[model samples]
Target: MDHVVVEPDSSSFSRVARALDDEASGEQWRAELATDLHAALELGVATVRGSLMGMATGGLDDGHEPLRQAVSASVESQVRMSGRGAGARIRARKITLRNFVNAPKRLNSRRGWRHPVHGDTETWVTQIGAPGWFDDPLRRLHARLHSAAARALDNRARRIARRG
Candidate 1:
């Protein structure tokens, strides 16, 4: 025969159980999470934009100033959530940087380009620029962005607890 048993203390358990059973509280939590997540995404976008601006100017030739200006002017972000509450997933709305950076000339700047020397002579001269201009910063900042989103959710949980 086994006699040992384990259970949550009644007061704490009932408080949590009641909160979970309340539909309004669930909705409130989801709304707050969405808000927090959006803020985090905006922060991430701004940070990446700043980095991209620096990379564009510092790595590219002065002739590419337009690219730097475009980055500063055009970088933007949006966040969207799908599914309900607990199952919900937040994602950045599709980025439109492609429209600005995917053009034939821009793509060469992004991926790095070599010039035809002396009117298509046998020599090739590569230009100086930050290759992987768009992806490198994002890839570098991926961990920081994830932590920011997680911190927002953690803050949301703390906020809900305080309200409860």
Candidate 2:
């Protein structure tokens, strides 16, 4: 496991910094600038990750069209916000929506780890994004989805046994 360090620059912190700058007051700005920026970046990345995960896996289990639509709507809204909030200038985009458009593409295409023996069996651990953005959330989502699938299968087997 490679330790992927997220080294953001002044450009990436500019927008959120400005926003927090205007809103933050006195000690909040003075004492915790670094901490505030870190928290904001974490939160911003979390939002982006959540949006991507929802879009990528929302329909997986039951192929729920409504859930997919909701996720689509959410991402579209984020894209729209990215367009309006700071256009391409949002500092958070570097860790958040920098490649927002490309994320779904990578999730579908490059992210699969196919079973060696069972070619059709694969997991969605996204081979996407820089260190902070895609891989971490993708791995977490894969684990969560795998766990959910196992639980569903277990319930199904129990039902079958009961029927038998």
Task: Provide the lDDT at 118 for model 1.
Answer: 38
The lDDT per prediction is: 0.55, 0.38
lDDT of 1 at 125: 70
TM-score of each: 0.48, 0.25
The CA lDDT at 107 in model 1 is 33
Where in model 2 is the C-alpha error above 4 Å? 1-103, 106-134
TM-score, cand. 1 vs. native = 0.48
What clash pairs does model 1 have? none
Q: Please name the candidate that would achieve the greatest TM-score relative to the true structure.
A: 1
